[model samples]
Target: MSTTTPGARIEVRGLTKRFGGFTAVDDLSFDVEPGRITGFLGPNGAGKTTTLRMVLGLVRATAGDATIGGVRYVDLPDPLRTVGAALEATNFHPGRSGRDHLRVLADAASVPTRRVDELLELTGIPAAARKRAGQYSMGMRQRLGLAAALLGDPHVLVLDEPTNGLDPEGIRWLRGFLRRLSAEGKTILVSSHLLREVEQTVDDVVIIANGRLVKAGTMADIKGSPGAVVRTSDRAALAGALRVADVTSIPGEDDTLIADTTDLRLVGDVALRAGLPVYGLEPKRADLEALFFQLTEGTNRNETAATAAPPEGDAVTAQEGANP
Candidate 1:
Protein backbone atom coordinates (compact mmCIF):
# COMPACT_ATOMS: atom_id res chain seq x y z
CA MET A 1 0.00 0.00 0.00
CA SER A 2 1.11 3.54 -0.69
CA THR A 3 2.37 5.42 2.33
CA THR A 4 1.37 8.81 0.95
CA THR A 5 -1.68 9.63 3.03
CA PRO A 6 -3.62 12.89 2.95
CA GLY A 7 -2.88 15.32 5.77
CA ALA A 8 -5.25 17.43 7.87
CA ARG A 9 -4.90 21.02 8.93
CA ILE A 10 -4.79 21.85 12.66
CA GLU A 11 -6.46 25.04 13.77
CA VAL A 12 -6.54 26.61 17.22
CA ARG A 13 -9.05 29.45 17.55
CA GLY A 14 -8.78 31.77 20.54
CA LEU A 15 -7.78 28.88 22.77
CA THR A 16 -7.38 29.73 26.42
CA LYS A 17 -6.67 27.54 29.45
CA ARG A 18 -6.46 28.82 32.98
CA PHE A 19 -5.67 26.92 36.16
CA GLY A 20 -7.15 29.02 38.96
CA GLY A 21 -5.57 32.52 38.95
CA PHE A 22 -2.65 31.44 36.78
CA THR A 23 -3.21 31.18 33.04
CA ALA A 24 -1.55 28.26 31.33
CA VAL A 25 -2.50 29.31 27.79
CA ASP A 26 -3.89 32.73 26.93
CA ASP A 27 -5.94 33.29 23.84
CA LEU A 28 -3.50 31.48 21.59
CA SER A 29 -4.14 31.03 17.89
CA PHE A 30 -2.17 29.36 15.08
CA ASP A 31 -2.67 26.92 12.24
CA VAL A 32 -0.65 23.87 11.26
CA GLU A 33 -0.96 23.45 7.52
CA PRO A 34 -1.44 20.12 5.86
CA GLY A 35 1.64 18.36 4.44
CA ARG A 36 4.04 20.49 6.49
CA ILE A 37 5.93 20.20 9.74
CA THR A 38 5.19 23.02 12.17
CA GLY A 39 7.44 23.58 15.18
CA PHE A 40 5.56 24.46 18.37
CA LEU A 41 8.20 26.25 20.43
CA GLY A 42 8.62 28.02 23.75
CA PRO A 43 10.69 27.90 26.92
CA ASN A 44 9.98 25.58 29.84
CA GLY A 45 6.46 25.97 31.37
CA ALA A 46 5.51 28.36 28.56
CA GLY A 47 2.19 26.59 28.00
CA LYS A 48 3.48 24.62 25.01
CA THR A 49 2.69 21.32 26.71
CA THR A 50 -0.60 22.68 28.01
CA THR A 51 -1.64 23.82 24.55
CA LEU A 52 -0.79 20.47 23.04
CA ARG A 53 -2.73 18.74 25.76
CA MET A 54 -5.75 20.91 25.04
CA VAL A 55 -5.35 20.13 21.34
CA LEU A 56 -5.28 16.42 22.05
CA GLY A 57 -8.26 16.66 24.48
CA LEU A 58 -6.18 15.41 27.37
CA VAL A 59 -6.99 18.62 29.19
CA ARG A 60 -10.01 20.86 28.99
CA ALA A 61 -9.67 24.42 27.81
CA THR A 62 -11.36 27.27 29.60
CA ALA A 63 -12.45 28.78 26.30
CA GLY A 64 -12.12 28.39 22.51
CA ASP A 65 -11.43 25.30 20.45
CA ALA A 66 -8.66 23.25 18.85
CA THR A 67 -9.53 21.25 15.81
CA ILE A 68 -8.01 18.80 13.34
CA GLY A 69 -9.61 19.26 9.92
CA GLY A 70 -12.33 21.40 11.55
CA VAL A 71 -13.23 18.60 13.96
CA ARG A 72 -12.23 18.50 17.61
CA TYR A 73 -10.00 15.57 18.63
CA VAL A 74 -12.74 14.16 20.89
CA ASP A 75 -15.14 14.00 17.95
CA LEU A 76 -12.84 12.27 15.51
CA PRO A 77 -14.31 9.07 14.07
CA ASP A 78 -11.13 7.15 14.76
CA PRO A 79 -8.64 9.24 16.70
CA LEU A 80 -5.88 6.65 16.46
CA ARG A 81 -6.00 6.59 12.65
CA THR A 82 -6.59 10.34 12.41
CA VAL A 83 -4.09 11.82 14.86
CA GLY A 84 -1.17 10.03 16.52
CA ALA A 85 0.46 11.65 19.51
CA ALA A 86 3.41 10.88 21.79
CA LEU A 87 3.49 13.63 24.40
CA GLU A 88 6.17 11.97 26.51
CA ALA A 89 8.44 8.95 26.25
CA THR A 90 7.63 7.66 29.72
CA ASN A 91 3.98 6.86 28.99
CA PHE A 92 4.37 3.11 29.05
CA HIS A 93 3.64 0.14 31.30
CA PRO A 94 6.96 -0.67 32.95
CA GLY A 95 6.31 -4.41 33.07
CA ARG A 96 5.38 -4.82 29.40
CA SER A 97 7.94 -5.52 26.67
CA GLY A 98 8.40 -2.76 24.11
CA ARG A 99 6.90 -4.90 21.35
CA ASP A 100 4.06 -5.98 23.61
CA HIS A 101 3.34 -2.39 24.53
CA LEU A 102 2.78 -1.46 20.90
CA ARG A 103 0.81 -4.64 20.34
CA VAL A 104 -1.56 -3.73 23.13
CA LEU A 105 -2.08 -0.24 21.72
CA ALA A 106 -2.55 -1.61 18.21
CA ASP A 107 -5.11 -4.05 19.49
CA ALA A 108 -6.99 -1.27 21.27
CA ALA A 109 -6.90 0.80 18.08
CA SER A 110 -7.83 -2.19 15.93
CA VAL A 111 -4.59 -2.04 13.92
CA PRO A 112 -3.20 -5.12 12.24
CA THR A 113 -0.60 -7.09 14.24
CA ARG A 114 1.81 -7.22 11.27
CA ARG A 115 1.95 -3.44 11.30
CA VAL A 116 3.43 -3.59 14.80
CA ASP A 117 6.53 -5.41 13.55
CA GLU A 118 6.67 -3.11 10.58
CA LEU A 119 6.87 -0.08 12.87
CA LEU A 120 9.37 -1.78 15.18
CA GLU A 121 11.71 -2.28 12.22
CA LEU A 122 10.91 1.12 10.75
CA THR A 123 11.80 2.86 14.03
CA GLY A 124 15.06 0.80 14.24
CA ILE A 125 14.05 -0.87 17.51
CA PRO A 126 13.35 -4.44 16.38
CA ALA A 127 16.54 -5.74 17.97
CA ALA A 128 15.31 -4.67 21.41
CA ALA A 129 11.58 -4.84 20.84
CA ARG A 130 11.19 -7.82 23.13
CA LYS A 131 12.94 -6.17 26.07
CA ARG A 132 10.84 -4.98 29.00
CA ALA A 133 10.10 -1.26 28.83
CA GLY A 134 11.49 -0.89 32.36
CA GLN A 135 14.84 -2.07 31.08
CA TYR A 136 14.86 0.23 28.02
CA SER A 137 17.01 3.30 28.11
CA MET A 138 15.45 6.70 27.57
CA GLY A 139 16.45 6.60 23.92
CA MET A 140 14.99 3.15 23.46
CA ARG A 141 11.77 4.26 25.13
CA GLN A 142 11.57 7.25 22.80
CA ARG A 143 11.78 4.95 19.80
CA LEU A 144 9.07 2.73 21.25
CA GLY A 145 6.77 5.71 21.86
CA LEU A 146 7.30 6.81 18.27
CA ALA A 147 6.49 3.31 17.07
CA ALA A 148 3.28 3.43 19.10
CA ALA A 149 2.35 6.78 17.59
CA LEU A 150 2.66 5.38 14.06
CA LEU A 151 0.82 2.13 14.68
CA GLY A 152 -2.33 3.25 12.91
CA ASP A 153 -0.59 5.06 10.05
CA PRO A 154 -2.04 8.31 11.34
CA HIS A 155 -2.59 11.28 9.07
CA VAL A 156 -1.53 13.81 11.70
CA LEU A 157 1.18 13.62 14.37
CA VAL A 158 1.70 15.62 17.57
CA LEU A 159 5.07 15.01 19.24
CA ASP A 160 6.38 16.80 22.32
CA GLU A 161 10.13 16.82 22.94
CA PRO A 162 10.61 13.77 20.73
CA THR A 163 14.40 14.19 20.68
CA ASN A 164 14.94 14.43 24.45
CA GLY A 165 16.78 11.12 24.86
CA LEU A 166 18.28 10.75 21.37
CA ASP A 167 21.97 10.93 20.60
CA PRO A 168 23.44 12.78 17.62
CA GLU A 169 22.94 9.86 15.24
CA GLY A 170 19.41 9.15 16.47
CA ILE A 171 18.49 12.80 16.23
CA ARG A 172 19.78 12.89 12.65
CA TRP A 173 17.78 9.76 11.87
CA LEU A 174 14.63 11.30 13.38
CA ARG A 175 15.04 14.44 11.29
CA GLY A 176 15.09 12.36 8.13
CA PHE A 177 12.21 10.21 9.38
CA LEU A 178 9.98 13.21 10.15
CA ARG A 179 10.81 14.75 6.78
CA ARG A 180 9.82 11.52 5.05
CA LEU A 181 6.51 11.52 6.90
CA SER A 182 5.90 15.10 5.86
CA ALA A 183 6.68 14.11 2.28
CA GLU A 184 3.93 11.53 2.58
CA GLY A 185 1.56 14.45 3.43
CA LYS A 186 1.22 13.97 7.21
CA THR A 187 0.59 17.12 9.18
CA ILE A 188 3.07 17.28 12.06
CA LEU A 189 3.23 19.60 15.07
CA VAL A 190 6.35 19.02 17.13
CA SER A 191 6.99 20.79 20.44
CA SER A 192 10.63 21.01 21.34
CA HIS A 193 13.16 23.29 23.04
CA LEU A 194 15.93 22.11 20.72
CA LEU A 195 15.91 25.22 18.58
CA ARG A 196 18.80 24.14 16.37
CA GLU A 197 17.27 20.77 15.57
CA VAL A 198 13.82 22.26 15.00
CA GLU A 199 15.32 24.87 12.68
CA GLN A 200 16.73 22.15 10.47
CA THR A 201 13.53 20.08 10.61
CA VAL A 202 10.43 22.27 10.49
CA ASP A 203 9.04 24.20 7.53
CA ASP A 204 7.05 26.61 9.74
CA VAL A 205 6.99 27.68 13.41
CA VAL A 206 4.47 28.74 16.04
CA ILE A 207 6.20 30.46 18.93
CA ILE A 208 4.53 31.25 22.25
CA ALA A 209 5.63 33.01 25.41
CA ASN A 210 4.15 33.59 28.87
CA GLY A 211 1.15 31.58 27.78
CA ARG A 212 0.48 33.88 24.86
CA LEU A 213 1.02 33.94 21.09
CA VAL A 214 4.20 35.75 20.19
CA LYS A 215 5.08 34.81 16.60
CA ALA A 216 3.92 32.39 13.96
CA GLY A 217 4.95 32.00 10.32
CA THR A 218 7.06 30.12 7.79
CA MET A 219 10.77 29.85 8.64
CA ALA A 220 11.92 32.16 5.84
CA ASP A 221 9.22 34.74 6.47
CA ILE A 222 9.89 34.91 10.22
CA LYS A 223 13.67 34.92 9.86
CA GLY A 224 13.18 37.62 7.23
CA SER A 225 16.18 38.81 5.16
CA PRO A 226 19.82 38.23 5.94
CA GLY A 227 21.74 40.98 7.72
CA ALA A 228 25.00 42.29 6.36
CA VAL A 229 28.28 41.44 8.10
CA VAL A 230 31.11 43.76 7.11
CA ARG A 231 34.73 44.01 8.07
CA THR A 232 36.67 47.16 7.32
CA SER A 233 40.12 48.57 8.16
CA ASP A 234 38.54 51.92 9.09
CA ARG A 235 35.92 51.00 11.74
CA ALA A 236 35.01 54.64 12.61
CA ALA A 237 34.51 55.59 8.96
CA LEU A 238 32.25 52.55 8.30
CA ALA A 239 30.18 53.31 11.39
CA GLY A 240 29.68 56.95 10.28
CA ALA A 241 28.71 55.82 6.76
CA LEU A 242 26.16 53.35 8.12
CA ARG A 243 24.68 56.14 10.27
CA VAL A 244 24.32 58.39 7.20
CA ALA A 245 22.43 55.62 5.41
CA ASP A 246 20.14 55.22 8.43
CA VAL A 247 21.39 51.66 8.96
CA THR A 248 22.34 50.40 12.42
CA SER A 249 25.35 48.20 13.17
CA ILE A 250 26.90 46.35 16.10
CA PRO A 251 30.54 45.62 16.69
CA GLY A 252 31.72 42.06 16.29
CA GLU A 253 34.88 40.25 17.34
CA ASP A 254 38.18 41.13 15.61
CA ASP A 255 36.81 44.62 14.82
CA THR A 256 34.15 43.38 12.39
CA LEU A 257 30.77 45.19 12.16
CA ILE A 258 27.38 43.53 11.79
CA ALA A 259 24.92 45.82 10.02
CA ASP A 260 21.18 45.46 10.62
CA THR A 261 20.03 46.17 7.07
CA THR A 262 19.30 43.49 4.50
CA ASP A 263 20.23 45.69 1.52
CA LEU A 264 23.85 44.81 0.76
CA ARG A 265 24.08 47.36 -2.02
CA LEU A 266 23.13 50.17 0.36
CA VAL A 267 25.87 49.26 2.83
CA GLY A 268 28.38 48.78 -0.01
CA ASP A 269 27.52 52.13 -1.62
CA VAL A 270 27.81 54.00 1.66
CA ALA A 271 31.18 52.38 2.42
CA LEU A 272 32.39 53.00 -1.15
CA ARG A 273 31.45 56.69 -0.94
CA ALA A 274 33.13 57.00 2.46
CA GLY A 275 36.32 55.54 0.95
CA LEU A 276 36.53 52.82 3.68
CA PRO A 277 38.83 49.87 3.03
CA VAL A 278 36.54 46.84 3.09
CA TYR A 279 38.03 43.47 4.05
CA GLY A 280 34.93 41.27 3.84
CA LEU A 281 31.16 41.48 3.55
CA GLU A 282 28.52 38.74 3.73
CA PRO A 283 24.84 38.18 4.52
CA LYS A 284 24.00 36.35 7.75
CA ARG A 285 20.63 34.93 8.62
CA ALA A 286 19.71 34.87 12.31
CA ASP A 287 19.78 31.32 13.66
CA LEU A 288 16.66 29.93 15.28
CA GLU A 289 18.22 30.00 18.74
CA ALA A 290 18.89 33.73 18.57
CA LEU A 291 15.45 34.44 17.14
CA PHE A 292 13.77 32.30 19.78
CA PHE A 293 15.56 34.15 22.57
CA GLN A 294 14.75 37.52 21.04
CA LEU A 295 11.06 36.65 20.84
CA THR A 296 10.59 34.92 24.21
CA GLU A 297 12.96 36.80 26.48
CA GLY A 298 10.83 38.91 28.84
CA THR A 299 7.55 37.11 28.27
CA ASN A 300 8.25 34.18 30.56
CA ARG A 301 7.17 35.62 33.91
CA ASN A 302 4.46 33.02 34.32
CA GLU A 303 6.91 30.36 33.27
CA THR A 304 9.26 31.51 35.98
CA ALA A 305 6.58 31.52 38.63
CA ALA A 306 5.27 28.15 37.57
CA THR A 307 8.68 26.65 38.24
CA ALA A 308 8.23 27.33 41.96
CA ALA A 309 4.51 26.79 42.42
CA PRO A 310 2.58 25.40 39.50
CA PRO A 311 -1.21 25.66 39.77
CA GLU A 312 -3.15 22.50 40.56
CA GLY A 313 -4.21 21.75 36.98
CA ASP A 314 -1.08 23.06 35.27
CA ALA A 315 0.71 19.75 35.45
CA VAL A 316 0.28 17.65 32.29
CA THR A 317 -0.93 14.24 33.45
CA ALA A 318 -1.98 11.53 31.02
CA GLN A 319 -5.62 11.13 32.02
CA GLU A 320 -6.25 7.78 30.30
CA GLY A 321 -3.94 4.83 29.78
CA ALA A 322 -4.23 5.15 25.99
CA ASN A 323 -2.26 7.70 24.02
CA PRO A 324 -4.22 10.76 22.97
Candidate 2:
Protein backbone atom coordinates (compact mmCIF):
# COMPACT_ATOMS: atom_id res chain seq x y z
CA MET A 1 0.00 0.00 0.00
CA SER A 2 3.00 2.28 -0.16
CA THR A 3 1.86 4.95 -2.62
CA THR A 4 4.81 7.24 -2.05
CA THR A 5 5.52 8.74 -5.39
CA PRO A 6 6.94 12.21 -5.94
CA GLY A 7 4.35 14.12 -3.90
CA ALA A 8 1.10 15.29 -5.47
CA ARG A 9 -0.10 18.91 -5.47
CA ILE A 10 -3.11 20.07 -3.45
CA GLU A 11 -5.60 22.57 -4.80
CA VAL A 12 -8.44 24.41 -3.12
CA ARG A 13 -10.83 26.41 -5.27
CA GLY A 14 -13.41 28.79 -3.81
CA LEU A 15 -13.68 26.59 -0.72
CA THR A 16 -16.34 27.67 1.77
CA LYS A 17 -18.00 26.22 4.85
CA ARG A 18 -21.10 27.60 6.61
CA PHE A 19 -22.29 26.40 9.99
CA GLY A 20 -25.80 27.72 10.59
CA GLY A 21 -25.50 31.46 10.00
CA PHE A 22 -21.77 31.69 10.55
CA THR A 23 -19.34 31.22 7.71
CA ALA A 24 -16.29 29.42 9.00
CA VAL A 25 -14.48 29.44 5.67
CA ASP A 26 -15.15 31.93 2.88
CA ASP A 27 -14.30 31.38 -0.73
CA LEU A 28 -10.73 30.43 0.19
CA SER A 29 -8.45 29.30 -2.62
CA PHE A 30 -4.79 28.27 -2.59
CA ASP A 31 -2.32 25.69 -3.87
CA VAL A 32 0.20 23.44 -2.16
CA GLU A 33 2.83 22.37 -4.64
CA PRO A 34 4.83 19.18 -4.46
CA GLY A 35 8.34 19.04 -2.95
CA ARG A 36 7.77 21.91 -0.52
CA ILE A 37 6.37 22.61 2.91
CA THR A 38 3.49 25.12 2.74
CA GLY A 39 2.35 26.78 5.92
CA PHE A 40 -1.41 27.25 6.37
CA LEU A 41 -1.53 30.11 8.86
CA GLY A 42 -4.19 32.21 10.60
CA PRO A 43 -5.18 33.34 14.04
CA ASN A 44 -7.15 31.11 16.46
CA GLY A 45 -10.56 31.82 14.91
CA ALA A 46 -9.40 32.41 11.39
CA GLY A 47 -10.72 29.12 9.95
CA LYS A 48 -7.39 27.34 9.43
CA THR A 49 -8.68 24.00 10.74
CA THR A 50 -11.99 24.34 8.93
CA THR A 51 -10.17 24.75 5.64
CA LEU A 52 -7.99 21.69 6.30
CA ARG A 53 -11.04 19.58 7.19
CA MET A 54 -12.60 20.50 3.87
CA VAL A 55 -9.44 19.39 2.11
CA LEU A 56 -9.55 16.02 3.89
CA GLY A 57 -13.27 15.59 3.08
CA LEU A 58 -14.08 15.26 6.76
CA VAL A 59 -16.43 18.25 6.58
CA ARG A 60 -18.55 19.02 3.55
CA ALA A 61 -17.87 22.36 1.98
CA THR A 62 -20.77 24.71 1.41
CA ALA A 63 -19.20 25.79 -1.86
CA GLY A 64 -16.10 25.01 -3.91
CA ASP A 65 -13.73 22.03 -3.72
CA ALA A 66 -10.36 20.79 -2.41
CA THR A 67 -8.44 18.20 -4.37
CA ILE A 68 -5.30 16.13 -3.88
CA GLY A 69 -3.54 15.01 -7.06
CA GLY A 70 -6.55 16.54 -8.80
CA VAL A 71 -8.99 14.18 -7.05
CA ARG A 72 -11.20 14.69 -4.01
CA TYR A 73 -10.00 12.98 -0.84
CA VAL A 74 -13.06 10.69 -0.66
CA ASP A 75 -12.42 9.52 -4.22
CA LEU A 76 -8.96 8.21 -3.50
CA PRO A 77 -8.78 4.45 -3.90
CA ASP A 78 -6.55 4.21 -0.83
CA PRO A 79 -6.72 7.41 1.14
CA LEU A 80 -4.22 6.50 3.85
CA ARG A 81 -1.60 5.39 1.35
CA THR A 82 -1.97 8.59 -0.68
CA VAL A 83 -2.29 11.35 1.98
CA GLY A 84 -1.14 11.11 5.60
CA ALA A 85 -2.46 13.70 8.07
CA ALA A 86 -2.07 14.41 11.80
CA LEU A 87 -4.39 17.16 12.94
CA GLU A 88 -4.24 16.73 16.71
CA ALA A 89 -2.04 15.15 19.36
CA THR A 90 -4.65 13.80 21.77
CA ASN A 91 -6.35 11.42 19.32
CA PHE A 92 -5.15 8.15 20.76
CA HIS A 93 -6.77 5.89 23.32
CA PRO A 94 -5.42 6.85 26.74
CA GLY A 95 -5.44 3.24 27.91
CA ARG A 96 -3.59 1.90 24.88
CA SER A 97 0.18 1.73 24.71
CA GLY A 98 1.70 3.97 22.04
CA ARG A 99 2.78 0.98 19.96
CA ASP A 100 -0.63 -0.66 20.32
CA HIS A 101 -2.34 2.54 19.27
CA LEU A 102 -0.36 2.57 16.04
CA ARG A 103 -0.92 -1.16 15.66
CA VAL A 104 -4.67 -0.62 15.52
CA LEU A 105 -4.31 1.99 12.77
CA ALA A 106 -1.86 -0.23 10.90
CA ASP A 107 -4.38 -3.05 11.01
CA ALA A 108 -7.12 -0.80 9.72
CA ALA A 109 -4.97 0.35 6.82
CA SER A 110 -3.67 -3.16 6.11
CA VAL A 111 -0.10 -1.84 6.61
CA PRO A 112 2.58 -4.30 7.66
CA THR A 113 3.27 -4.52 11.39
CA ARG A 114 6.96 -3.88 10.77
CA ARG A 115 6.07 -0.51 9.36
CA VAL A 116 4.60 0.38 12.75
CA ASP A 117 7.97 -0.11 14.45
CA GLU A 118 9.66 1.76 11.65
CA LEU A 119 7.45 4.79 12.13
CA LEU A 120 7.80 4.57 15.91
CA GLU A 121 11.55 4.86 15.53
CA LEU A 122 11.23 7.41 12.74
CA THR A 123 9.23 9.75 14.98
CA GLY A 124 11.70 9.14 17.84
CA ILE A 125 9.28 7.60 20.32
CA PRO A 126 10.50 4.00 20.53
CA ALA A 127 11.44 4.49 24.16
CA ALA A 128 7.84 5.42 24.98
CA ALA A 129 6.34 2.64 22.84
CA ARG A 130 5.49 0.50 25.83
CA LYS A 131 3.90 3.27 27.89
CA ARG A 132 0.16 3.83 27.84
CA ALA A 133 -0.77 6.93 25.85
CA GLY A 134 -2.34 8.39 29.00
CA GLN A 135 1.06 8.53 30.61
CA TYR A 136 2.75 10.28 27.70
CA SER A 137 3.43 14.03 27.68
CA MET A 138 1.99 16.36 25.04
CA GLY A 139 5.14 16.18 22.95
CA MET A 140 5.21 12.39 23.14
CA ARG A 141 1.56 12.21 22.07
CA GLN A 142 2.42 14.39 19.09
CA ARG A 143 5.12 11.96 18.08
CA LEU A 144 2.74 9.01 18.40
CA GLY A 145 0.13 10.78 16.30
CA LEU A 146 2.71 11.51 13.63
CA ALA A 147 3.87 7.90 13.64
CA ALA A 148 0.30 6.76 13.07
CA ALA A 149 -0.11 9.22 10.20
CA LEU A 150 2.96 7.78 8.46
CA LEU A 151 1.94 4.16 8.95
CA GLY A 152 0.76 3.89 5.36
CA ASP A 153 3.78 5.77 3.91
CA PRO A 154 1.71 8.35 2.14
CA HIS A 155 3.10 10.92 -0.27
CA VAL A 156 1.26 14.04 0.95
CA LEU A 157 1.18 15.17 4.58
CA VAL A 158 -1.40 17.61 6.03
CA LEU A 159 -0.47 18.39 9.59
CA ASP A 160 -2.24 21.01 11.74
CA GLU A 161 -0.20 22.58 14.54
CA PRO A 162 2.17 19.60 14.78
CA THR A 163 4.56 21.68 16.89
CA ASN A 164 2.13 22.85 19.57
CA GLY A 165 3.55 20.79 22.42
CA LEU A 166 7.16 20.33 21.32
CA ASP A 167 9.98 21.78 23.38
CA PRO A 168 12.65 23.79 21.57
CA GLU A 169 14.65 20.63 20.86
CA GLY A 170 11.56 18.77 19.67
CA ILE A 171 10.57 21.73 17.52
CA ARG A 172 14.01 21.83 15.93
CA TRP A 173 13.84 18.10 15.23
CA LEU A 174 10.38 18.45 13.67
CA ARG A 175 11.60 21.30 11.46
CA GLY A 176 14.47 19.20 10.12
CA PHE A 177 12.18 16.23 9.67
CA LEU A 178 9.67 18.18 7.60
CA ARG A 179 12.44 19.65 5.46
CA ARG A 180 13.78 16.17 4.81
CA LEU A 181 10.30 14.99 3.87
CA SER A 182 9.97 17.86 1.39
CA ALA A 183 13.42 17.05 -0.02
CA GLU A 184 12.10 13.55 -0.70
CA GLY A 185 9.37 15.19 -2.85
CA LYS A 186 6.47 15.06 -0.44
CA THR A 187 3.78 17.78 -0.55
CA ILE A 188 3.45 18.98 3.04
CA LEU A 189 0.80 21.45 4.29
CA VAL A 190 1.28 22.46 7.90
CA SER A 191 -1.27 24.65 9.72
CA SER A 192 0.19 26.75 12.51
CA HIS A 193 -0.46 29.95 14.44
CA LEU A 194 3.19 30.17 15.42
CA LEU A 195 4.51 32.71 12.93
CA ARG A 196 8.20 32.38 13.87
CA GLU A 197 7.99 28.62 13.69
CA VAL A 198 6.23 28.65 10.34
CA GLU A 199 8.66 31.23 8.96
CA GLN A 200 11.54 28.87 9.58
CA THR A 201 9.76 25.69 8.49
CA VAL A 202 7.81 26.56 5.35
CA ASP A 203 8.91 27.53 1.87
CA ASP A 204 5.47 28.91 0.97
CA VAL A 205 2.59 30.32 2.94
CA VAL A 206 -1.20 30.67 2.60
CA ILE A 207 -2.54 33.08 5.20
CA ILE A 208 -6.22 33.60 5.95
CA ALA A 209 -8.42 36.01 7.90
CA ASN A 210 -12.17 36.17 8.52
CA GLY A 211 -12.39 32.82 6.74
CA ARG A 212 -11.05 34.35 3.53
CA LEU A 213 -7.75 34.19 1.70
CA VAL A 214 -5.54 37.10 2.72
CA LYS A 215 -2.23 36.22 1.09
CA ALA A 216 -0.41 33.39 -0.66
CA GLY A 217 3.10 33.24 -2.06
CA THR A 218 6.58 31.82 -1.64
CA MET A 219 8.36 33.05 1.48
CA ALA A 220 11.03 34.73 -0.58
CA ASP A 221 8.49 36.56 -2.73
CA ILE A 222 6.53 37.70 0.29
CA LYS A 223 9.51 38.88 2.31
CA GLY A 224 11.56 40.29 -0.54
CA SER A 225 10.06 43.76 -0.29
CA PRO A 226 13.00 45.24 1.56
CA GLY A 227 13.58 47.97 4.14
CA ALA A 228 16.36 49.14 6.42
CA VAL A 229 16.86 49.96 10.09
CA VAL A 230 19.13 52.85 10.99
CA ARG A 231 20.32 53.82 14.45
CA THR A 232 22.05 57.05 15.52
CA SER A 233 22.61 59.05 18.66
CA ASP A 234 20.80 62.00 17.08
CA ARG A 235 17.64 60.22 15.98
CA ALA A 236 15.63 63.46 15.53
CA ALA A 237 18.37 65.00 13.39
CA LEU A 238 18.45 61.93 11.11
CA ALA A 239 14.68 62.09 10.66
CA GLY A 240 14.85 65.72 9.46
CA ALA A 241 17.75 64.89 7.14
CA LEU A 242 15.92 61.90 5.63
CA ARG A 243 12.85 64.09 4.96
CA VAL A 244 15.02 66.70 3.24
CA ALA A 245 16.44 63.97 0.98
CA ASP A 246 12.90 62.82 0.03
CA VAL A 247 13.28 59.57 1.97
CA THR A 248 10.58 58.71 4.51
CA SER A 249 11.53 57.35 7.92
CA ILE A 250 9.55 55.95 10.81
CA PRO A 251 10.46 55.36 14.43
CA GLY A 252 11.85 51.91 15.16
CA GLU A 253 12.94 49.95 18.21
CA ASP A 254 15.67 51.35 20.48
CA ASP A 255 14.94 54.87 19.20
CA THR A 256 16.25 53.92 15.74
CA LEU A 257 14.53 54.89 12.50
CA ILE A 258 13.11 52.50 9.91
CA ALA A 259 13.30 53.52 6.29
CA ASP A 260 11.12 52.01 3.57
CA THR A 261 13.99 51.49 1.14
CA THR A 262 16.72 48.86 1.43
CA ASP A 263 19.56 51.16 0.37
CA LEU A 264 21.72 51.79 3.43
CA ARG A 265 24.23 54.03 1.68
CA LEU A 266 21.58 56.59 0.72
CA VAL A 267 20.52 56.78 4.37
CA GLY A 268 24.11 57.10 5.57
CA ASP A 269 24.78 59.90 3.08
CA VAL A 270 21.65 61.71 4.19
CA ALA A 271 22.79 61.51 7.83
CA LEU A 272 26.28 62.71 6.89
CA ARG A 273 24.86 65.73 5.09
CA ALA A 274 22.86 66.59 8.24
CA GLY A 275 26.11 66.44 10.29
CA LEU A 276 24.74 63.51 12.32
CA PRO A 277 27.11 60.64 12.99
CA VAL A 278 25.90 57.23 11.85
CA TYR A 279 25.91 54.89 14.80
CA GLY A 280 24.40 51.81 13.10
CA LEU A 281 22.56 50.80 9.97
CA GLU A 282 21.38 47.38 8.84
CA PRO A 283 19.10 45.87 6.22
CA LYS A 284 15.73 44.74 7.51
CA ARG A 285 13.28 42.36 5.90
CA ALA A 286 9.53 42.36 6.38
CA ASP A 287 8.54 40.44 9.47
CA LEU A 288 6.13 37.58 8.82
CA GLU A 289 4.44 37.94 12.22
CA ALA A 290 3.81 41.64 11.62
CA LEU A 291 2.34 40.90 8.22
CA PHE A 292 0.17 38.12 9.64
CA PHE A 293 -1.24 40.43 12.30
CA GLN A 294 -1.73 43.25 9.84
CA LEU A 295 -3.77 41.08 7.51
CA THR A 296 -5.88 39.38 10.18
CA GLU A 297 -6.34 42.32 12.56
CA GLY A 298 -9.87 43.40 11.69
CA THR A 299 -11.18 39.88 11.14
CA ASN A 300 -12.48 39.58 14.67
CA ARG A 301 -14.89 42.44 14.10
CA ASN A 302 -16.52 40.79 11.13
CA GLU A 303 -19.77 38.99 11.87
CA THR A 304 -19.31 36.44 9.11
CA ALA A 305 -16.38 34.76 10.84
CA ALA A 306 -16.62 31.78 13.19
CA THR A 307 -14.26 29.56 15.08
CA ALA A 308 -13.26 26.26 13.44
CA ALA A 309 -15.38 23.34 14.45
CA PRO A 310 -14.12 19.81 15.01
CA PRO A 311 -14.40 17.82 11.79
CA GLU A 312 -17.39 15.62 11.06
CA GLY A 313 -17.67 12.04 9.66
CA ASP A 314 -15.58 8.91 10.09
CA ALA A 315 -12.78 10.25 7.93
CA VAL A 316 -11.53 12.07 11.05
CA THR A 317 -11.88 10.50 14.47
CA ALA A 318 -10.71 11.82 17.81
CA GLN A 319 -8.04 9.14 17.70
CA GLU A 320 -7.25 9.64 14.04
CA GLY A 321 -7.62 13.15 12.62
CA ALA A 322 -7.11 14.93 15.90
CA ASN A 323 -5.62 18.22 14.73
CA PRO A 324 -6.65 19.30 11.20
Put down candidate 1 lDDT per residue, 145-223, tens digits, no spaces.
Answer: 8988888898999999999999999999999999999999999999999999999999999999988999999998887
TM-score of each: 0.85, 0.83
Against the reference, the lDDT scores of all candidates come to: 0.87, 0.84
Q: Name the best candidate (by lDDT).
A: 1
The clash number for model 2 is 5
TM-score of candidate 2 against the unseen true structure: 0.83
| Backbone clashes under 3 angstroms, per model | 0, 5
lDDT of 2 by residue, 126-160 (tens): 99999999999999988888888787778899998
